[model samples]
Target: KGYGSGGKVTHANVFIGSLAEGTSEATLKDAFSPYGMIKSCYVRNKGDQTYGFCEFNTVSEAEAAIAGMAGKNDWVVKFANNDAWDDEVPHSNVYIGNMTEGTTEASLRATCGTYGTVESCTVKTDTETGKNYGFVKFSTQAAASRAIAALNGNDGWTVKAANNDTGGGGGKGWGGKGGWSDGWVWQPGPSTRNDDSRPEGPPSDNLYVKDLPPGITEDEVFAAFSKVGQVVDCYVLRWDNLSACAALVRMASTEQATRAKSQLSGTIHESCFGPISVKNQEKNGEKLEDHVYVKGIHCTTSEDQLRSIFGKYGTVMWCRILPLPFRAGAGSSSVPDVAALVQFASPEEATTAISAMDGKVATEFGAPMVVRFAEEKANAKRPAPTPNNNLYVKGWPVGFPEFLLQSEFQKCGNVVRLRLLDNPDPEYPTCAALVQMSRVEEATMAVTALHGRPLQVPLPPMRVKFAGKDQGADNSNLYVTSLPRTMTESQIRQSFSKFGEIERLKLLTQQGKPETHALVQLSSPQAAAAAIRELDGSTPAFKG
Candidate 1:
C-alpha cells in the first residue's frame, strides 16, 4: 500500500536515511507530516557531523518507505521492529559530511525527506572552517543498515554507518564512499591473532647455560642430555649476587631441547646450596616458539621449605641463595640478607614460581616481593596529557558503581557533600567527581584511602581540590542537598564512617523551623580532607 495510506498505521517505529546536511527535528516532522502524524524526531551531532533518530505513528508507513527506497541513490530507507532498539542495534545512525556553508537544521531535513520519512536531522558547522559536517539518526536500525550497505563505497559523498551506542555501524557516507577496510598489513600495534608462526626456516635462537657451581658446573647440565649429543656452551648469567648465578648450556642443535626432553627434564644438579633439574626447551614440528624464566629462594627458611613450596608446581632448572645488598653506611650496614632468583628449565616452571611465590613473603621481609615478565627497555617519550586531568587507578574491582563511594568513605567520618563533575556535553562524559567532608581529617583520610584506588568511573588517579575564591586552608564545615527523602541519619553516618569519626548529622526538612540542607560535622580536619578528596560532587545529593 502507499505510505501510511492503508488501515491505521501498523508499525509505530520507522527508519529514515539519505538525509542531507543541516536537517533538524522540526523540519523532519514537517516533511513526514503528509504520511501520518509523527512522534519525536531526534538529530544529534558528532564534532562537526550530524546524526540522530526519530519515531513515527505507524509501522505500515515505515515498511512502505523501506520497500520503496531500499537501494535508491542519494537516500535510502528501512525499518526495524521496535523491540530491536537497544545498546546493540546496528546501523541506526548515519554521518553526513561535505555540506555547503550556511547549512541549517531545516535545510538538512528537507534534503533527507527525498529518501523516506525525514527523522530529525542537523548540520553542524566547524567554527574554524565554517564548513558543514553533521549526522542523521534513523528510527530503526534496519533502515540505517540498509542505507549504509547501499551507499558505502559508492561515489561523491562519503557515508558510513554511525558507530552505535553499543558500537555498531550505520550506513556509509553520501556518494557511497569511506568505509572500513579488511586488508592485512602488519606494523606495530595490538594484534588479536593467537598464532604467529613463520612457515619456513629454523627457529631464530637456541638456549645456552654457563657459570654453574665450579664442582658440578659442566657435568651438571650435560649429564642429563648425554643421550642427545655433546653440550655446545655452558656458562652462567652473572649478576652481582654470586648465589643467584644462572647457568646457560646450549644444546648441539635446537632439536636437543625436544629430543632429550624425558631424561634432561628430571635430572637434578647437586650444588653447594641445593639440587637443580634439567628439561627440554620446546617441541619440534610445532610452529609455536616459547621462552623460560627461573626463580626460587630461601634464607633461614630451610631448603625443604623452598622445595615443598615450589617443587611440586614445575620443573626447577637452577636455585641459589644470593647475598643481600651491602649496607650503605660503613660498619653499621654489615648484616647478611637472603635473596635468590630461580631459573626454571621451562617457561612453565618460571611462571609457576611467579604465580605461586612472586608476591609471597618467603622469608621475614616486610612486604611481598614483586614478580613480572621481563622485557627489553625501549626509550620512548612519555605521552602528553590530552587537556584533561585523567587519573588511572589499579587495585579496585571492576564495574564498581559510582554510588559506592559514599559507603566506602563512611567508615572514617561524616560526609557533608558529594558530587560527580558534569561533562560539558552529554555525549562526551567525564570521569572525575568532587567530595566534601565535614572535617578536614575525614577528607584527609578519604584522600589517603582513595589515592591509589580505581575510580568507579574512568578517570586519572589525581584528586582535584574544591574550586572556591579563597582556595586555601581546608573547608571542613559543609552541607549537602537533594538527598533522597527516604535517606536516614544512620545511613548517612554509615556512608561517611570510612573517612573518620562523625561528630553529628542533621537532615534537612521542610517541616523544620529553619529550612536547611543536610549538614554533617566531623571530629578532625584530616577526616574532612579525606572526604573532600574522594567523595565531592559525585553523589546524587550534590550533583547540582
Candidate 2:
C-alpha cells in the first residue's frame, strides 16, 4: 500500500518481502522469533508477491535481523517504510518498448492507466526516420513497478529502466511487497532484470553510455566499448524526452562494466547531449548482480574476519556479519543459523569466492562452513538431509530437563519431538531416548557427528541413528561403493556374510555397464553399521 514515510527504524519492526512458497508464519517466527522478544510475526500474499512484517523487542534486535538478512537470503528484509532503500530519484520515469508500430504516448498512458496512474507515457521517435518505440513514466516507483509488471511482455509491449535521475515513477506508490520497486528494477542502461531470478550484484555487462554522436550504429558502440570487456551486445535506445539515441552496452560481468565505464565515459562525442556519460546500468545505487549471499556465520565472527577471507579473491564491495536471531519463548533452545552477504566488484568474483570459501568453515565457536548465494526466494533444497525427519539418540543422563535434553540435540537441528525413558531401579536398567529432528538432513548430520560424542562427564558416548519408521531403504539394503571392478553382487554378499544375514544383493550399473558399486541390504542397522565400519576401507584384494 502507498509506502509513505512511516516505517521508522526506531519503532523496532521491519518489513520482509518476496517470501518463497511454503514459507509459513511458523517458519518466519522460528527464524526471526529468536532476534528478541518478538512482538509479532505475520505474512500475507497475493499472486507472486508474498511478504511479512515482524516486530522485535528492541531496535538492536531489529538491526541484528536487518544486517543478517539484508544480503543473506531470498526474503527481502528491510526497515519497514523507512524510505531508506527508496532513494530520492526521478519519481515518474520508465522505459516501455515492444509496441505495435502505430502506438502513441497518449495511447500508452490510457492503456497503462488501467493498471495504475500514469503520469507520462510516450513513443520515442527517430529524429531522422521518425520511428517511435513505446515508453511510459509513472508518478512513483511503486506505480511504475506495478505498471511494468502489468504491461511488460503483454500483447506487444516490453518495459525496462529509464536512463535519467528525473524521478521514480511520477504517480502514487503500490501497496505490495518491497514497495513494488527499488533501484534494481530499472536504470536507463544495459541488462536490467525486472523479472525472473532474485537480483544479485550489479548488472555485470550492462553499460549505460549516453551522448553518442547522433545516429551511432551498434557496431560503433561495440568498437569503442570492446577495449575494456567483451561486448556481448550493443544497441542505441531512445528514452522519454530524449531526442538523441543513448547507447547501451552489455558486458559479461561487473569487471567488464567497470572497465568499460572507466575507459569510455566522459569521452568527447560530437552529439547533441555533449560529452558521453559512460557508467553502470544501475538501480538502488549498486550493481544488482555483484553481491554474494553468505551463510553459516558464527557469532564470534566479525565483518573484518569475513573481509579478510573473502577479499583474497578480488575487491570486496562490502562484508557484513549479522548476529543470530534469538527466540526465548521456546520448546527447544535451538540456535539460529547465522549469515551475511558480501558484495564483490563482479559476479565472477562472487563465484570465485564461493568456490574458495564453501566448506572451508573455520570459525571460532563452530565447524568450518560454506557460503551460500543469498537468494531472495528460498530455493527448494534438501542440502544434506534424509528421507524422513527423525533421529534416534541412545544416551541418557538421568535428571536432565526435557528442554535441556532437547537443547543438547538442538545443536544439530530443530527438535520436533523427543521421547525419553529412564531406568533407575534395579528391576529395570536402561537409559535411552528418541529425537525427531525437523529435517531429514539434520537428522543425518546429527547421526554422523554426535554418534560418539562425550559430554564432559562420561557415562557413555552417545549413539545417534536414523529413526525413520519405514522411509529409508529396506533394512536388507546397503550402499557399497568402490568395489573391485570385476566383483559381483554374490561375491560381495559372500564377503560381507561374516557380519550377518544378507537379504539381497544387487550390482548397480551405468548405461548397461556394471559399475564398481553394489547395493546390499542386511537384516539390521547394527549389521550395516558394523559391516561399514569393518570393511568400508579394507579394499580386500580379489583374483580378478
lDDT of 1 by residue, 115-201 (tens): 334445667777887767767655444445444444455544456655432111111221111111111100111121322232222
Off by over 4 Å in 1: 1-404, 420-432, 452-544
RMSD after CA superposition, every candidate: 26.5, 28.5
Model 1 deviation from native, Cα RMSD in Å: 26.5
Using Cα atoms with residue i matched to residue i, what is each candidate's TM-score against the true structure?
0.24, 0.20
Q: Against the hidden true structure, what lDDT does model 2 obtain? A: 0.50
lDDT winner among the candidates? 2
Could you tally the backbone clashes for each prediction? 109, 55
For candidate 2, write residues 304-340 as lDDT tens digits. Answer: 6568867888898887654333211111111123456
Q: Least lDDT summed over 10 consecutive residues: which range in candidate 1?
A: 326-335
After best superposition, candidate 1 residue 518: deviation in angstroms? 36
